[model samples]
Target chain A: MFDYKLLAALAAVIEQGGFERAAQALGLSQSAVSQRIKLLEARVGQPVLLRATPPAPTEIGRLLLNHVQQVRLLERDLQDQVPALDEGGLPERLRIALNADSLATWWARAVGDFCAERGLLLDLVVEDQDVGLKRMRAGDVAGCVCAGDKPVAGARCIPLGAMRYRALASPAFVARHFAAGVTAAALARAPAIVFGPDDQLQHRFFAMLGGEGGFIHHLCPSSEGFVRLTSGGFGWGLVPEQQVRGELERGELVELLPGRVIDVPLYWHHWRNGGELLASLTRHLEKYTGRWLVQV
Target chain B: MFDYKLLAALAAVIEQGGFERAAQALGLSQSAVSQRIKLLEARVGQPVLLRATPPAPTEIGRLLLNHVQQVRLLERDLQDQVPALDEGGLPERLRIALNADSLATWWARAVGDFCAERGLLLDLVVEDQDVGLKRMRAGDVAGCVCAGDKPVAGARCIPLGAMRYRALASPAFVARHFAAGVTAAALARAPAIVFGPDDQLQHRFFAMLGGEGGFIHHLCPSSEGFVRLTSGGFGWGLVPEQQVRGELERGELVELLPGRVIDVPLYWHHWRNGGELLASLTRHLEKYTGRWLVQV
Candidate 1:
């Protein structure tokens, strides 16, 4: 059996991003927090945290954190059953990793009801769809909404639906770049808008057209800014169909190739033992995601 | 003299977050990029990059990166003056760190005209008002909008004005939590909505009312979601006055203590030698910020 207090110390250190802040959160002294970490490492026979400006967990530390996250959920379930175990009747806080596009488009509407109904609070960590699973591996979130369908060990992945992204640009951009023809070669020459370095939607779209090399691109990390840049004639980008309805209707933005759209499948991943709350959220998303996302 | 090629390789590695992607961006082999970094470190007689999963700059590395950022701006100015030096007329990209609240409220409208007129592109990195200057120190961005008025060495800080925030909650939340009276003790017991662990606005607000020590808070990192959580009766939070006008008018939300407001002063930090483009942008912001931000 593991010492739950030690595990809590480890989790708090990673979550708060430093030992000092973790100590404050835990209502312990900085020295005491450091001592707990030392004890934890001594018991494990290895270092749990890398000694850095802002400490990060080692591989063993990540495994322990994963254990702590599951324990937290199970504890919450227990607290629900035994009201005496509840602390101050504070709503449970659930850390989630979600893509920015979802947060910008339909996330609030989809999850707002569940959160309010359950008296749950969310701590959202924004990550790219392609790499959101890393947050799970790092034990930074209880669950994640990401593109890939694979689940990490001890986690379940469920299909929520797909976000249909159309290759969109301002009408002025289409006239300037795609006037000659919307071909793989032409796309390679024209500038594109990438969400960030981790985003591969543009690369995948290009690969689908048999264009396999690098291209001219501008990186814009914000979902709102991504759409604004696309419509402002900065560059063509893959934008969610749901998000661009108004722009499309106004004729401000147009598709690069009409009818050519990429359906990025969205998956909800949660710990297998994440208890009733995650289960309820899963069911809720499965029921309501159809309204905003296309069937895959 | 510093070799611009070596500097370009360093910038690309940090910007792309990895050597392979940096190599791809620079149209070079991964091994060549590694060699460039090694050569740079050898010349500097110290390590430039932290050999981490996602490489970070060391202290000297940050200094060099600051130099590189300024040089890029100067090069763009030079290219603008000498059209023959321009490479394919690609718009120059300026990365700036901004707080999410400002980004959600008034950023786009404030900078839209300037970007369009100058044919420039933006890569915005979202950081908290208190910690945004760290991005500039880490050499992650060319400029930053943050709460601090002090500039780092070799940078200029300009007062951009202020964002006024009021402690607001859903009408239902206010009635439930503040029915007795909105005292410091009542506030200490009531749940609050915090943007993140980095956000100190709630703490500052409470401190202003002579309430010290921690309070229960639900962290919602997204600006839009923060408002929704507050309006949904999850918790009271300090929200930008500009963002809550509609909710305020609709009677969905109300201030806990009427007429009690917190005005957070904002400052823009840029490298001293950031050249004509930065100078022009600085002037543009000075001319237009008064239309959006309250004078401090």
Candidate 2:
């Protein structure tokens, strides 16, 4: 098998794009890095690096780099477990990414409770569910709770649960714009609320309505802010059942589409090597959300 | 955070249930495994494994194992990219889990061709899309192609595409059972071929018929067998469009429900570490299956 250390050194060299730069970054002699590469090529029976003005990875080199990264992540995970050998020190910090809606609703509170109980600190990054993986890819956070099934490279994923959405409007807004049943044409004329430019629920709604135009839309990025905007009669929006249940019961928000609700399956994605912190967080979230999210 | 090595050792120990067995499996001395466990406990500030009887992972230990496994996958990925420092063989063989249908259809051929070009070999395990994660959890495979949004803990996932299923039957079977327009009652008497005992396509069809019963099913474990059984006048089955398109054109099989087809979304799951071979394999699969599987 390939020597992991040597492969790592070669990766650093390729990433730095030159032996000199990679050697400096790795605190190794340039000649040593060169020799390492030579040895590697002999073993693989192919040239992994193309030495030129700027060093570049051959296709094989790219493959090796990918492998090296995975090994590194595994190593890091092993390192994390070393701390569990004792119980005296403070727990290590965790970093996570989540959608705004989940953050505003029960997710944050649940995470806070977990952190407090475990004596762990958490760094949270908020983003749209569609783009949460991007943050994870950039290493801005170690894990993410998002809607998509796809995980970024080098990250582990799990199913927390699904989030249900119901079409809702403030009683006043409904009274103004939806006096008649929501017809294909009438919906196009009504005002609607969207989470942001990237939000596609409204688009999906229109598609379900046979691609007819029906509504003008207002953009609200924050989950809390979106709720407020809808409650203040800005427009109709799909609200999470858990978040707007009280409003619906209190007659503040009316279910526009009572029988037909949308369900977005939510998943948890994290660096596969993220350790105990992510597991605890995932289990806790699943325990609570399992009761709420749609089964399947 | 948890130390990955400690967690891995703990998981292995728990799986093996003895220091000797665990050490043998891990290629380490019994003393090394013992030392690693001690270090792990110190780091986690809790007892991760109970030494009574066959060793078992504590809740905390299980949690740590989840993280460590994910990281290890990532590390493997990283290692794949680096060049070797000495003359040695390629890294360890890659293990993968794939949906039965994908394996039987074009995917197997595509993957085989790619691996041959790259001088890599893969160990493949066939599984249903729904249960592929369980295999990954048991460490049976390093990655999987499954049909769900949620991934197993410490595994990275991405959307592979979709598999479209059309209700199909042999011409002879259709002539005998479906001469009359198929209704819920008519379907109940018809014999159907299904992928396995856990196959639910027929149930889904029944549910769509206002909860009426439809079709008695014959379980076939192989995707290719399911198609052949249906085409050879055994029963009707929901077959992938790609798999049945040729047969349908040849009048060997006929569509039962032309407009109403089931669309199953598929996703790719693997250890998150950057493995070059895995990445290249994934890219090739994605490119080949693009539009062939789903619109995306």
Candidate 3:
């Protein structure tokens, strides 16, 4: 069996950038850090880290670091379940990957409440859905909320319900550009605000009408900025229901197409055997995310 | 030589999700989309697309998609140089990846001004620095502004300047937490705000005085939220100088440690062969980022 202490040492060296810094983090002398690494290398018969400026882990070292991080997560979960180990210390910081769109809208407030109630801390890796799942599969995060329903090779997939999106444009924009309604010709004339090329929500909506060509498009990556730009008569966009609810009610934003909506199915992917801590966490997410998302 | 038309068809299929939708996007029949894919696969002597329910690209197909994206970027640059292809239409939308820290502070305004002045549009891929560079190398984006000096292989690295970070806390938070001076014991009691695990700026600062233990942290993924949380006296945090200058000047936030700063050097990584178009863009960045960043 691999010694976790050695793995922690290896991870510390790569993350903190040098043996001296790692030693400082571990409250050990620099010589002790070197000795631990030497001993660990003797055990594995391979050097784990490259001796370079701002040292990076070798392939094997990277795998070991991943394992160390995994173990650290498991330890946190253990601490959460068996509170006898708390011993008057703070809650362990659990890192998870999530998309920015969710974070900006309702997810943060909901997750913050849950984390606070549970006396837990969170560290988020904010990225696109696919990348978040990829990070989850790489063992970088405990779980991820993503756009797909499929679970990674060894993960559990929980359907978090679809987030319904509507084509939103300012009334002024409609007056200026799309006064003739959202037809194929009108679509060609009006500029559309897109998250990115890989954002298929617009395409899925566009396919029903068969008119996505030769249109000027603005790409705004930030959810808040996207809403601001869309609300301020910049362009038309596909915005989530929760994000546009207040604006829509206030008549600041209008749905380009009535009745028709784009629904993006999001999933929570986590290790199936994540135990009590994750199970409890997912239950809270189910309650929060389920309420925010549209009915399937 | 590969048939770019066939590759484009395949990319549309994967991106748009089905052959039928790809046909719609291309303004062609579904059968024609299938025929193009068949011909492309025949040329490669292997299936490039899996033809799965949602449609996915095979390994070779992913590479070709990346290549096509590269060619598209080159074509935009070429169009910029040739001028004949303007054809009285809108300017090209260039996709670039950059970190949130840059986005929330001065980068967005600078990029917006540059794009406006140049008659160009921008699609930003927002993520952490290393992830941004990875996307650049994979041809998912044309360029990225990121921390660190290392450029991806075959990319030009320009040292934009160092983003100096400072440990900051609200006056009320300092009064409550550091009334006993900033000791390791006090640090253990006082919570901290960090961007993520890879954000070791706090730890680097924490190590100099040496106290970091089980301190509660609120992981705010958004730079705007980070500043908001820190300024509201929720916790002490290491914020970039540019981001917190207004708050610092107004006495809403104070530096936790004076004279101990974290200088995170940021670089502009772009294709070396990006030609006159990218060169002009970089010149603007040098003017903008250089002016905003501290001389260190």
Candidate 4:
């Protein structure tokens, strides 16, 4: 069994980029910080940090850092529940990965509020929903808000809600490109906006409409750019309802498929044994998700 | 050795997200596409293209795909030199990754012009210079233009030049925040914009000015957002000269350090065996980079 204090010290050294700074941050002597890391490495039979200017954690060290971060979150949760243990010394951190759509729209505000209220720092990584789960599996994050319900071993998969998406185009774009209606031939000739080459949402929407044309013609990988470009009449694109809700309501963007919502289920996957903090976060996420997302 | 045609078919299936469509893309029957992929997998004694709606390549399969993409680029390069082999069937594609700063500013137009002239499809992935190299190492990209001189084992590294950066803030911001003068005490209380947590540019500038404060106060991961936020007087940042050259000229953004330029050297890294196509592409990049970037 690894000592929590040692793990914390190792995390500090890697995160602070050196021992001296970590010592200052931790309010411990530099000698103490160095001794703790050396002891941890001796126990693990491997050196933790690759000594460089702003040292990087070795592979084994990264795994240890992940564990330490998870433990730190859990301890903070415990401290909250047992208020007597709250020293109010350092703020805890929650490491999570989110999809770009969520980051660009309603979810950013929601997560920001939650983190603020809980007095937690968020280390959020943005990736595609399709690829976000890879980070969770690699131990780079405590949890990941990603697409699909494919559960991994040793993780709790909670279906948050279905994020409704729709095909949208500016009024002029529909008139210019799809004057004959959004038919197979029309779509084949029309340029479409895609997040990236791997983005499957647009293709999924097209397949639903009984037509699959070009995969990626106008690539706007940034989520904000995707919304603006599609809304500016550059091309028709499948965009999250949350992102285009204002545009749709104001008549700035017209829905290509009226009343047809392609629902992609989002699942919050976390370590099954991740204690009360993970449970509390999951509850908050599920509640916030239901307010904004369409659930069946 | 892996069969190039079979590997091409595999890439199409993973990219297009289905066998039927990969067949459509390759102008082959669905059965033929499946047969080619199966034959390649059988020869390698491993399954590739994990069965999903949009099929993903298995780890080994991804390796094969990367190799195939590299080979395709080289062949296209060869065809250009030996014009007799140009039957003019399909346009060749070049997969590359670029830093976002370069993309948002000057390099996009340049790359587009070169690709148009050469009749090559440019698939560009935007990532920070630090992380962009990982994509090249993983074979997700054929080449990368990124910061630093660290060359991959099998790749050639050419120093394009330094990308000069300066600490910039709007006139209003300078008047408001630095009325007390730019000192360590004042800076410690100032809000600063950073690309992300791992971004060290702002801190590097601060260190150079003999001050260091909180690393991340406001995070704006988008390069375009960073420039806009810094220019809007939200916070100070170290922005690329190429990106903010116009803003500096218009006096919309004032440089904190007039003559001090933080020069980050950018290098073009590609496979040593990438040959003719890579060579031609490098020349174009060098030309464009020189036009917009400082070569000394």
Candidate 5:
């Protein structure tokens, strides 16, 4: 069997992008990190790292890194179970990765209930749905609610549900920007909230509007922040109905393009084992969000 | 996060049904196995094993055992990929669980070319479709070519073609049992080869004959052997057409009931990871079997 410790060390080094940084993060001597990588290469029977500027992982290394990340997550879960055996003090910690929008709106209450029921200490990592798997693969989180159907290696995935997005804007923002009744031409001049460089809501909105989402943008990283920004009259956004239900009902956030909506499918991804906690959490979330998200 | 090692040990004991047996199978001392069980129970904060007759797992134990099995299979996959780093060695070992009928017929040959080209080793575990998931849950196999859509908790499942079964009998067997113009009543009186005590083909055939399959008296365990027994004049059987192609062509085996065939869907289950070896194998199997099996 391969030495899991060495593989883990190598994975950390690759992920951190430098021997010095990895060594510092892991609290190991630089030589020790270097030696571990060397040993891992020998065990693998091939050079796993591309010894160049910034040092990148080779194809085989990438595969091994995925395995190492899984092992580490499993290890952390094992560690958490240790204290539970004693007095059940220090409630088990649950580290979950999730998309910004879901985390901001529907997930917080569910997460709170999860923490309360299990007495679990919570560690939430917020990221875009597209990149949540990377966080899962890097051992940064134990579970993720993501948008992709394909799972990271060594992680388990199930369809937790999907979210529905509609083009929305603060009534003030719309009244100020588009008096010609929310056409593609009117949307072109409107400022919109962009989640990040990788965010596709703007693009999707443009596609629905029969044009591209113009560069007049306000960038917000958090889903809740994005919603708040949009509601505060910063710009238009494809807001999940659950997040802006009250605002829309009260006419604070107006549906800019009625009858045009996008369904974004979401899935639950986590380490294949230690699924009970995650399964229970899934059940809780499903009960509340079942009607809001599209069923696939 | 669960202790994979302890969970694996617990599952081993459940499968083996005794500490000694489980220890022997795992190559660990009986004391070690006992300690592992104690540790696992301690970790979960509940008793896992019943410790009664046969030492079966409790409900919680079964739940964790299921998770452990998934983890072990994924771990085996990681181990299987180790040899791929070697120069021109076998890339991986695919431990596959498949129903007897599929194994005996087109699946083996369909995958033969791909396995040969990649020098991939296959560990085949033959079982009935109903019990294949149990084998998968027990960590006996990494993937399954079975009939079902209900996924194993942590595995990825996709439809991988289907097969049609037709009732067949040797000319001698039919001639000895029935006169010309054999009817459903004649089939009920004729001795038939049931795949096993739990085999449903005979029951399905009887259902088609407007009766139940309990009418079958003789039972054979092997799919290949079942066909052989039928062709040797023991009895009639519901056989895959692919298995008895030569027999049907040479007048050795005759279709007992013409124009009546049963279509059974098949699916492939594997770890969700994008393993190249698995991807290649699945591609080859699907490409060949898609031509014969039902699309849906």
Candidate 6:
């Protein structure tokens, strides 16, 4: 049997990014936290943590973390069923990894009422849409929203509709860069705004356009900043249709290639045994997300 | 003399997150990029990169990157003077690290016109306000906006006013959590929405209120998401005054402690010898940022 106290210490250390902060969060002395980690490693018969600046979990540590996450969900289920087991009425915390674009647009609206009503708390880790699932695989999150449809060994993946993006730029940017016309070659030559290196939406768009070589791009990791940079004539980029409705309507931004859209299909990946709470949240997302995303 | 091509390869690898992608960006074969890195490493007589999943630069690599960044700015100045020396008229790229609160609120508005007019493309990296200068110190950015006023070696720091934050919550949340009145004990027990692990804004606020020990927090990394989550009644958080003006006026959000504000002093850090273009940008920020941020 695994000791939950030690498991919690490991989670706290990883989340707080240091032993001192973990101790502070856990209301324990730094030495106590360090002792707990050492005990856990001794029990496992190998090192569970990488002794680095901000400590990282080793492969075995990840498996233990995954087990801890699953056990937490199961515990939530038990607490829900037996109200007497609830400790201090602390709101349940669920860590989920999600892409930035979704968080910026419809995610809060879709889940707000549900979370409030259920008295649930969220720890949201933002990653690129293409790689959000990695957080789940690394045991850093209970669930994730990503473009990948395949599920991890103990996880289930559900289609959550698609976010449609259009290559958009400001009127001034179009007048400056696309004066000759929006061609693949012009796109290759002109600078574009990318969310981050992990974001392959622009690369996928280029692939669809049959442009081979790498294009000049300016990295702007924030979705809001991406739009602002694009509309400010810094570059053209794929903006989610839902996010730029006002911009498009106000003529602050225009389609670079009219009617050419990139629809990124999204999937919700959660532990198969994530308990009643996770199941309920999944149902809520399934019911509400269609209002914001194109049905996949 | 050092090779600029090797430095470019190093920058590309760091920016693109992998050698294959860096090679693609440079229009070179993977082997050629590998050879250049090896050659550079041999010349330095030590390992420049820590071959992690995403390669990280060693201390010496950071110094080289710093040199590369400075040279790029100086080269831009030379190109500005002698247009014939310009390569393909590619718009100059400036990498910067900044806090999310500023990016979400006043940053784009302040710099939009300047970037557009100057044809300067930005690669904006988002970091916490307290630690943004670390990016400049690591040579990952040409400049940064942070709470720290002390400059790194060979860097110049200028005060850019302060961003005022107020403890805010949705009206219903206040009614539920603070019905008895806003007290330090109650505040510590109630869930708070934190920007991230590195965000000490809430902790600082708690300290000012004479509250000790760790508080319950839910991490939401995005500024836009933070506002939406706060307004959606997830938790109370210290929100920028500029960001929540609408929510306050509309009565959707209310101050947890009225008139209590946390003013984080902002500073702009740039390379000391970053040449004419960087100096102009520094001047532009100095002239305009006060219009948005609270005068320090």
Candidates in order, TM-scores: namely: 0.81, 0.38, 0.68, 0.68, 0.39, 0.88
CAPRI verdict (incorrect, acceptable, medium, high) for model 5: incorrect
Interface C-alpha root-mean-square deviation of candidate 3: 4.9
Give the TM-score ranking, best first. Answer: 6, 1, 4, 3, 5, 2
Give the fraction of reference interface contacts each candidate recovers: 0.27, 0.00, 0.24, 0.02, 0.00, 0.63
Kindly report which residue stretches of model 6 are placed more than 4 angstroms away from their true locations once superposed: A16-31, A38-63, A81-89, A129-131, A179-181, A185-190, A204-212, B16-63, B81-89, B129-131, B207-212
lDDT of 1 by residue, B1-296 (tens): 88978988998888777898788778899999999999999999999999875688898888888787777788787885687875435467788988888776777668766876776767778877545787776666778988888898778999989999999988877887899988888898787888776677888888888986667777777776677678877788999999779789999889988999999999889877778998899888888987889897
TM-score of chain A of 4: 0.82
lDDT at residue B175 of model 5 (Cα atoms) = 74
Best by DockQ: 6
Docking model 4 quality class: incorrect
DockQ score for candidate 2: 0.01
Name the lDDT value of residue A38 in candidate 5: 92
For model 6 chain A, where is the 10-residue window of minimal lDDT?
A85-94
lDDT of 6 by residue, B61-104 (tens): 88887777778788888985698976546567788899888877
Tens digits of per-residue lDDT for model 4, B1-296:
65777888898787666898688777789999999989988998989878875687888988887887777766776775686765435666667777767655555445645554555555567777666788778887778888868888788778777778888888877887789787766665555666764577887877877874343345567665566557766568888887767678899899876877788778888877776777788878777777767777
Clashing residue pairs for model 5: A77-B1, B203-B213
Off by over 4 Å in 5: A1-296, B1-34, B45-96, B112-127, B133-142, B149-157, B196-216, B249-251, B257-260, B270-281, B291-296
Docking class of 6: medium
TM-score of chain B of each: 0.85, 0.69, 0.80, 0.84, 0.69, 0.88
In terms of lDDT, the best-performing candidate is 6
DockQ per candidate: 0.28, 0.01, 0.21, 0.11, 0.01, 0.50
lDDT of 5 at B8: 68
DockQ-wise, the better of 2 and 6 is 6
Candidates' C-alpha lDDT: 0.81, 0.65, 0.73, 0.72, 0.66, 0.84
